[model samples]
Structures are given as structure tokens and as C-alpha cells.
Target: MCWQFPLLGIVVDFGHYFVHRAMHSKFWYEHIHYVHHSLNDGGPLTAYYSHPLDFLLGITAPVVLGWWTIHGDLKAFLVYVFLAQVGALYIHSGQSWLGNKWHYQHHAKLKRVYGLFGISDFCLK
Candidate 1:
């Protein structure tokens, strides 16, 4: 019995959108995100290059908020978590992009890619 499906959807989407935006900020980039830059050629493993703090920010922020909002139910929490993980894997994947090399370009150029779902960046270009 899903008590709050619509609200949960809103929360999840908004959380992802805002959290992704936050990842592009200078503060995040300077400290934690820089580790991922070591990957001059991004691929599946590029996700692992992220600093632990950035990982916490990317994964835990929504989780903490979700925990605060939801009752103690493992089922809903697990589902939300699964979806988030799948999304993360896909976004980090080098498979889908206008150019398969765009991510590598960012790394090679030592610039940031602000698009969480793509290899595009206003600042990094």
C-alpha cells in the first residue's frame, strides 16, 4: 500500500535534480569532485574515482531527506534506493552521448561536465 506515491515521485525527482546541480558547484568541484577528474578516460569505473565525501553528498543527501520524510518501511526505501543506483550507473555510463568522447574530452581538458545525464557543460566547454 503506497501511501504517498505522487509525493514520493516529486521528492525523488526534485532531490535528484537539486543534488545534481549541487555537484556542479565550485565548492563541490574543488574538494571532492576533483578525484573523479583523475579519470582521463571515463568509463564504468569513473564513478568509483569520486571522493568519498562527494559520494556521500550524491547518495546520502536524498537518502537522509527520504528517511526523514518516510516512515520506517524497508520496502519503499529499498525501491527508491534501487532506482537511484540504476540512474547513477546510467548517467555515468559512456554509452549514450552525441559524442562518445565528450566525457573523455572533459577529463582531458580538465573541465567539469555539468549535465548529470549528458556530456555538456556551460563552464567546462
Candidate 2:
């Protein structure tokens, strides 16, 4: 069960990476993800400030995937949700601390660090 937490993180991170990568596409970017990207100088509150479609794809979908894969383990689900929200806030806070600079780079450059864990980017690249 303890080990499952790490596995859950990997699964959720992959989902995030896949959806975030897709959101970069021209169609998705223009129609959905553009709103979130508009906040280049993002803050913590702006972390989840995105279009409904963007939220569905980039946030909720990954959560659902994690929940399903984890066999509905409430503890694991809560932990994932908590960590993901904190990570999102930290990344968007525009503060350079403890490797959060990657997300800042994503907002600044719009071309890199599409994953929370970098797993998808690493595997795909």
C-alpha cells in the first residue's frame, strides 16, 4: 500500500503530462488551454483558473484516471489530490524554489516541462 502511493503519482503525472502535451496543440491551445496560458505571471490562485474544457482535460481527467487505477483507494486518492493541488499552486506561484522552476519555464517559454514528474516528456522525447 505504501508503495502504491508512488505508483499512483506516476500514473497521475503521466495523465497530466499527456493532457498538458495535448493542450499545446494548435486546436486545443486556441480553443481551451489559451486561457490558462494567458496568465504568464501566474499566482497560486491562478493555478486552476482555466477554461472548463481545459480543466476537464488537464485536471479532472488525470484525477479520474488515478482514482480508477488505484482501485478507489480513498487515502491514495486524497493524497494525490492534495499533492497535485499543492504542486499546481507552487508551480504557478512564480517563485523559484525546490525545482518548481520547470513549471515557470513552461509558462514563460510555452514549450517545455509539460509534466509534473517529467516522466512523459522523458519517455516521449
Candidate 3:
């Protein structure tokens, strides 16, 4: 059961990566995802400061995908959600030490670094 945590994270992160990438599409970005990009120099609170649709796409949808696909014990889902939110906050915190410098690049450049863990960016690029 414990081992499932990593697997669940991978699945959820994969879905999150794609959804985040999709949000960067011109149509999506202009209509929805742009709300998030507005916070170019954002802090932790900016993690949730997104258009409702962007939130759904960038956050909720990924969790839902994990819920359906992994459907593990409740503990796993809870841990995933917790970690996901924490990671979101960390990425949006504008703290370089958090280790995801590419996220900052995403906000700054808007054409690169479209994924959460960088896996999608690597593959899609």
C-alpha cells in the first residue's frame, strides 16, 4: 500500500502535466490560463489565484484523474492532494530555492516549461 504512493504521484503528475500544457494553448491561455500568468511575480497565495476554469484545468482535473485511475485507499488520495497543493504553493511561491526554477521561466516566457514536474515539458518539447 505504501508503495502505491509513488505510483499514484506519477499518474497524477502525468495528468497534471498534460492539463497544464493544454492550458497554455493560445485559446486556453487567452481565455482561462492567462489569469494565472497574470501573477508573473507571484507568491504562494498566487497558487490558487487563477480563473475558475484554469483552476479546474490545472488543479482539480489532475486530482480527479488520479482519483479515477488510481482509486487507491483514501489515505493515498489524501496524501496526493496534500502534496499536490503544497507543491503548487512551492512552485508559485517565487522562491528559487524550491528547486523548480523552470516554473518561473514559464511565467516569464510563457512559451516553455508548461509542466509541473518537467517531465511533460521534456517529452512534449
Which candidate number has the best TM-score? 2
Q: What is the per-residue lDDT of model 2 for residues 1-125, given as tens digits with 9 covering 90 to 100?
A: 56767887778788988898889999999989999989887789889889998898888988888879878678867877887889878878877867877777778799766877887778877
| TM-score, one value per model | 0.58, 0.91, 0.89
lDDT of 3 by residue, 1-125 (tens): 68767777666667877887778778988898888889788799988989998788777887777777866778877887888888888988877885878777778888567666766667768
What is the C-alpha lDDT profile of model 1 across 21-59, one tens digit per residue?
676678976777778776655466676668887767665
lDDT of each: 0.59, 0.82, 0.78
Stretches of candidate 3 off by over 4 Å are: none
Q: Which ten residues in a row are the worst by lDDT in model 1?
A: 115-124
In model 1, what are the clashing residue pairs, if there are any? none
lDDT at residue 107 of model 2 (Cα atoms): 81
- Top-down lDDT ranking: 2, 3, 1
Evaluate residue 1 in candidate 2 and report its C-alpha lDDT on the 0 to 100 scale. Answer: 54
Global lDDT of model 2: 0.82
Point to the candidate with the largest lDDT.
2
Query: What local lDDT score does residue 116 receive in model 3, on the 0 to 100 scale?
Result: 69
